[model samples]
Target: MPESRKAAAAMSKTGQTEPSAPATETSAAMGGSQASPKKVSQTGAAVEKIRSRIIDLTIPPGSRIDEPLLLKEFQLGRTPAREAINQLAAEGFVKILPNRGGTFVRKLDLAEIGEIVVAHQLVENNLAQLCRLDDETLADDLERIQTVYRVEVDNRRYLNITELNEQFHMRMNQSIGNSFFHDFAQSTHRHVRRLLVHLYTLESALPEQQDEQFELNVRQHDRIIEAVRDKDREALTEVLPEHAGATQDRLVRLLQSNTVAPFPVKLRPLVLPGN
Candidate 1:
């Protein structure tokens, strides 16, 4: 099977679109019982913390989120705990099931990941062709983003690392000088960051491995920004696909080894487990 096909199968098997576990194995793995709470006093603070934890992968993908556990962990009450989940659901960070069943974190698999990779290619390539920004501004901004990512990664401030990375890419998109393209890039920022976030984090596999990958990424950013600076549309046609392909490669391997899981079908799934 092709790498994409293999990735698709893995994602479909693990995708958690709804709060319910679609796969028998995953559902079984999440097995147990926890008591529900009655009410709580404050929800706003509880929700913010819950949102942060889920986004930071503190809760982790596929880890069953029991409200009572959250209640106790955060020292909050039932109402607050429930509200936290509700907000997460709205952001597609966590999916809430109907009738008080279960909540599954939205896990994007390799295939859904592949699609986003392709989107990156489309946007970045065209952006490169149309880049009309001043070299000084682009260089300065890219450097700032790099500085932040390096500092955050070195300090183990993983969340900040992703935000910095996103800032760099968004700056790249805006370099295109097209309002429409800029809007598209802005809309996709959340999804792109969600995928890239894991890829950047997984490099913690080894000290050498992580540091080496970080250096290479910084170099890559330098190259892409340099391409924009030089108006190298030809170079970008070659570069952007390789960039996205690297993301695909990273996503496939990590999703397989770490069990990162696939996205659950929001509407009708184009693919399913074992197809």
Candidate 2:
């Protein structure tokens, strides 16, 4: 079977449903006149399948996405495939180069990494202040994710660790009860996740270290949980940014050492002020 087909099947079995675009908008974007509601729904499903692959790096960064291949893989018509690609482009996940017909996943931006760190700090600090979090509210959820996270760390399942780590933070953010804040935080988490996976994949090729970083990550989770338990807003303001900043630093060091390069793509790098 083709890779996309295999992926679709696997996702079907797993019942994974990370959110994606709305079918109505997606169909309209790709010439909706001929699009029935059923076709539009299929277009949405196709978009999610491709989006999930990008999120997990299954398609890997720097890979070109052939529309014909996607159409064939998902058994989607031209309108649906084109629509999915267009949606991905708008979302910053893929780029369509001028004079180049192929669509490629957007490369990692070195400068944006720093900016994302700063943005995360600002947003999370505000969230920490606005929300009233306490142990009683977050304890059960945090404990459940932490249990799985610890096991993943010990087993050296870095990808699983990344997912659970995000879940742990997601649970913390859920305390805010504001959908907009929660969604923003989730998007930031996805960017951070790509960086983590990049480092872990690079590390896998080298001599095995003591896994100190993973251990520290777990400890950081503990600290965040404790801060929530104590209703220590000051502690949260300090630790959450620190956690993201530390990851930023690590990624920079890795890039500097040439241990790993950003995913190769055609788009110009996003350079923020003072970057």
TM-score of each: 0.57, 0.71
Candidate 1: C-alpha RMSD to true structure equals: 14.7
- Candidate 2's TM-score reads 0.71
Candidate 2: how large is its RMSD?
Answer: 8.1
Taking the tens digit of each residue's C-alpha lDDT, what string does model 2 give over 1-275?
24434533444455442232222233344454555778768877887678667766788777899778887788988887888888778666788886676888877565555556666665656666665574375865576566656656676655556666677776666666666676677777766666677677766654343265666677877887788777788988778766766675555555555565554532232333544
Candidate 1, residues 1-275, lDDT tens digits: the string is 24434433443454311111112223244552233433332554576466556556777776667687777888766766777788667656677766657887766664556666766666665665566555557766566556545555566555555556666776766555455566566545555766666666675664575566566666777777677667676775666555645665565555556544444532222232344
Which candidate should be chosen as best, given TM-score against the real structure?
A: 2
| Candidate 2 residue runs with Cα over 4 Å from true position | 1-45, 134-136, 206-210, 253-275
